[model samples]
Target: MRRLVLTSLLLAIVVIGLGAYTRLTHAGLGCPDWPTCYGLIDVPETSIQIAAAEQAFPERHVEPAKAWNEMIHRYFAGSLGLLIAVIAFVSIKLRFSKSSKVRYPIFLPLCILGIVTFQAALGMWTVTLKLMPIVVMGHLLGGFTTLCLLFLLYLRINARRINTQGEKLAESQLKKYSSYALIGITILTAQIALGGWTSSNYAAMSCVELPICQGDWLSDLSFEQSFDLIPPNQESYEFGHLAHNERVTIHVSHRFGAIITGAFLAWLAITIFLKAKTPSIKNTATILLSLLVIQISLGVSNIWFSLPLKVAVAHNLVAAGLMLSLIALTYKLRQNSEESLYE
Candidate 1:
């Protein structure tokens, strides 16, 4: 079960990476259909198949390369889903087995199973909704949520093993750090959501200048349209709507969010390093600081380079990595707290 949980986490990371790749390559609508590529099991190969696909979905031409990118991502996601299901089933089975420890509840798996199912629906809507910004952002959030849940499960399983080995930190100290970690995670989550909104709305390059938007402290901004979820069918959102001001609003807001998130995390890391006695706590804080620097650098690179594909994808990857590092910190602190209570 532990191995399955670990495998699921790795697969979740892969799914996130592939999703980023597909989005960056503008292949979200590669298939123009859900769960299938060109109305076939795979990308259209022969000339006849390509012609048939074009005939069937005239609006969506067959781009074998992009279609393959989308299909491969879907395949990996489906595999991850199946693996999660198996983890859930095996977890439940173990609870009833003769050597059952019953230390872990079946509810966590059940919850993750449900989340994965909903994530699949979000994935379909991302394509079927004509790349609606709202749906695309939702899909991105769903993927990250899945990764976080799987990471938590992995931590819980390991916590049990660690407790059995009688390794524990001071409960008072662990609790203090755990609280700060929780606060940091909450801020980072909001930051990531803002990032999703910015990317889905194609607003990353809205303000090409750095440290400011449109070379001014104030500009024409429309919060309503910027955050608007509904789009008219008449408007071709292929490159996104012509709401130039709204895109700037999103871009500016994300920048402000980055400042707040970065400040909070910096404070948290320093506090941990200066006050914590445990080597694990100190080491995690060091890693957290390193990731924070890298993430900010990537964000800057995205702007300086005008949202280059590789840089944008790397930005997404680093954001996910930062979240996981914080999660690990929280998990470690919680583990110490649990063991402290047992002792």
Candidate 2:
């Protein structure tokens, strides 16, 4: 079960990276179909295969490179699903074993499996829906959430193993900061969602300048259109009508959210360093602070350089890492608090 959990964690990380790459390269709709690329197991490259693909997807031209990118993402996602399924089964088996050290309920692994299945559906809709902003953002969030849950499960399992051997921490060291850390997680999640929305709507290029948007602290913007999730009746999978002002609304809102999230995290890190009793807690805090800095730098570079592909993709990846760090810090605090109950 440990091996399975570790495998899933690594694969989940790859999926996140590949997902970001696909989106950055505009390959979300590269296949124009789900579970297959141009109606084949792989992208069509030969003349014969290209002709067949063109015939089948007449309206969608065959781009071999983009199609391969999407298919690779799908394949990795499918492999991750299999790993999670194994985890669910093994965990359920361990639940009945009196000798097992695992403390988490069987339901957690099962829940992750269910989430992976739902994520698969979202992946399909991402293509069939023509990269609709809402669905795309949801897909991105779902991927991150899956990774977060799996990582937490890994930590819980290992911590439980250590505790079973009587090595658990003895005091409620981070009790005072627990709630604040959780609140920081919530705000960071919202900021990530805003980032997803901005990316999906192609709003990142709206300003190209940092502190101010379009050379103005405030500009004419439309929140309604910017946040619109309603799609037209037409089957065409294209971006909904969005004016420059609406895009600006999304871009600026994401910027504001970043400011709030960054400030809160900075305060949380300082407090942790000064008050945390354990080296593990202090190290997690330090890592979180470092990731926060890198994430901010990526965000700025993305804009300053007019959304270069590599920087943009790194921004998305670092955002995931930031979430993982917060999840770890908060989970550790909870574990310590629980352990203090007996002493």
Model 1 regions lying over 4 Å from their true place: 234-236, 336-343
Task: Identify the runs in model 2 with alpha carbons over 4 angstroms from their true place.
Answer: 98-104, 164-173, 234-240, 337-343
CA-lDDT, candidates in order? 0.84, 0.84
Reference-based TM-score, model 1: 0.94
Candidate 2: tens digits of C-alpha lDDT, residues 1-343: 6678988998999999999999888888889887888888888999999999899999899988888889999999999999999899888888878896545457779999999999999999898878888889999999998999998888777775556665444337666687998999899999999998988887888887757886653656778768878655446535434778888899899999999999999999888878877777888899999999999999999888888888988898899889999988887777762452221
Candidate number achieving the greatest TM-score relative to the actual structure: 1
Please, what are the lDDT tens digits per residue for candidate 1 over residues 1-343?
Answer: 8899999999999899899999888888889898888778899979999999999998887899999999999999999999999988997788678886455657888889999999999999888787888888888989998999898888777766666766554446557678888999999999999998888888888999877876653756778778877866632355677488888899899999999999999888888788878777788889989989999999999899888888888888888888988998877776644543211
What's the lDDT of the predicted structure labeled candidate 1? 0.84
Which residue pairs overlap in candidate 1's backbone?
Answer: none
